[model samples]
Target: MLDKHQAVQSHQKKSSRQKLAKVLLATLPMLTVLGATAGLSSCGFQLRGYDTPMLFDIAKTAVIIEDNRTAFPLKLPLTRRLEALGLDVIDNMTLADIANNSNNVGADPIAAITVNNIRFKRYELVGVLTEIRLVLSADVSYQTIENGKPVTLSNPIQVERSYQYNEASVSTDDQQGNQIRDWLYDTLARRITDQYVAISLPKVAPASANKSSQTLKSPEKTTVIVPSS
Candidate 1:
């Protein structure tokens, strides 16, 4: 009786093994079909598209900060953004510096952006423990030579933000305000970048409707027109 029971138990174990093997064999084709996708997911693959725009790839750009105290810090972030587009960030200090950078890269600057005339305004709020509104405006322009003509381009950007504040949390409110200011400055920089990437090379140096956003070329004495589009 004991030998018969042992034989029966061994048979059951073998059957279980055979079932698992059959299941694996049945799914082998499906697993093979998903092997590549599974490998990508296991390796943490992400499908982010190209970082630089087609027109701005490997182009040289310069960010020139004017004497506006409020806008001085805007140059750094704008330069960083431009460099992220695969542009070579070169200093535009003097002719010698420009020549050195150009010689090293064997290319002239595709565009030169000048930022100035920054304005900041704070409206008086009726309640101190309520919301405060801040406005930031900047004048940005890029000068580029196209078809042997000096062309200057400008775009208008102004960032406004409001946040709730409490007098009890003075430190927190102050910190929040600083962060908001930084964000505003970054927004202004990003707008200039968008304008450059979106607009094609200007054919006749057309300015915008707002004169404050117009950039005039100093390298040549020529006429500049306006274009809203």
Candidate 2:
């Protein structure tokens, strides 16, 4: 009778081990998925937000407008965005001071000059003045005073924006146009910041820096008006 009871206890232990193995096998896939999700979260996977990081090198910057007629509308929005990036914005910087850094007395500051041109063209659809196409072209350049000499960090970076006309409601069309304008402003500002980050930032590790350097390129040139001192 004792031998029979010992055999029964051994069989029960084997049965318990088999049950636990089945349970672990069933949950293995879920555990793997959870682990992968946690790993991605730790590797900088994030939902996009408005407060994106600014990784530019310079601390203080001045925005100078060459054409007030076309670029004036964007001034306030650009200044606000630059300030949001924790930059020291100098409102009184002139275009002459940007091109030639002779007049800057104390610590030299970086300068950005924006020249804009806007045009509207009317389109006739089936013999009716149905749509208007508004085109805004902007050119932004950057200059910095390094060691008592002016250096052109970036040439004129051109950004163009346009949208189709909606003639259904006057107010709605106006609002849409304003929205597009705001989007263009934001896009231009982002492009400028990206360019600065690409050129100025020091090289990091081989893998990450190489990936970032691929999206960067040089800018072009444009004429700018000199503001009175």
Taken over the whole model, the C-alpha lDDT of each candidate is 0.67, 0.58
- Which pairs of residues clash in candidate 2, taking residues 3 or more apart in a chain or in different chains? none
Q: In model 2, which runs have C-alpha deviations exceeding 4 angstroms?
A: 1-57, 67-69, 98-106, 114-133, 145-149, 153-173, 203-229
lDDT of 2 by residue, 1-229 (tens): 9999999999999999999999999999999977755554334222233122334445667777655555666677667655554566777777766545545566455655444443323333432334434445555566654454556653555455544554654555467567766676666667766565455443334544544555455334568999999
lDDT of 1 at 5: 100
lDDT of 1: 0.67
Residue-by-residue lDDT tens digits, candidate 1, 1-229: 9999999999999999999999999999999857744543334222234222244432566667775568777878888766655566665664345435545654555556767688888865757676779899877776665654557777767889998777676465477788989988898888887786555332322224233334343345679898889
* Global fold similarity of model 1 (TM-score): 0.55
Q: Which stretches of candidate 1 lie over 4 Å from their true place?
A: 1-53, 67-69, 94-110, 168-173, 200-229
- RMSD of candidate 1 to the truth, in angstroms, is 17.7
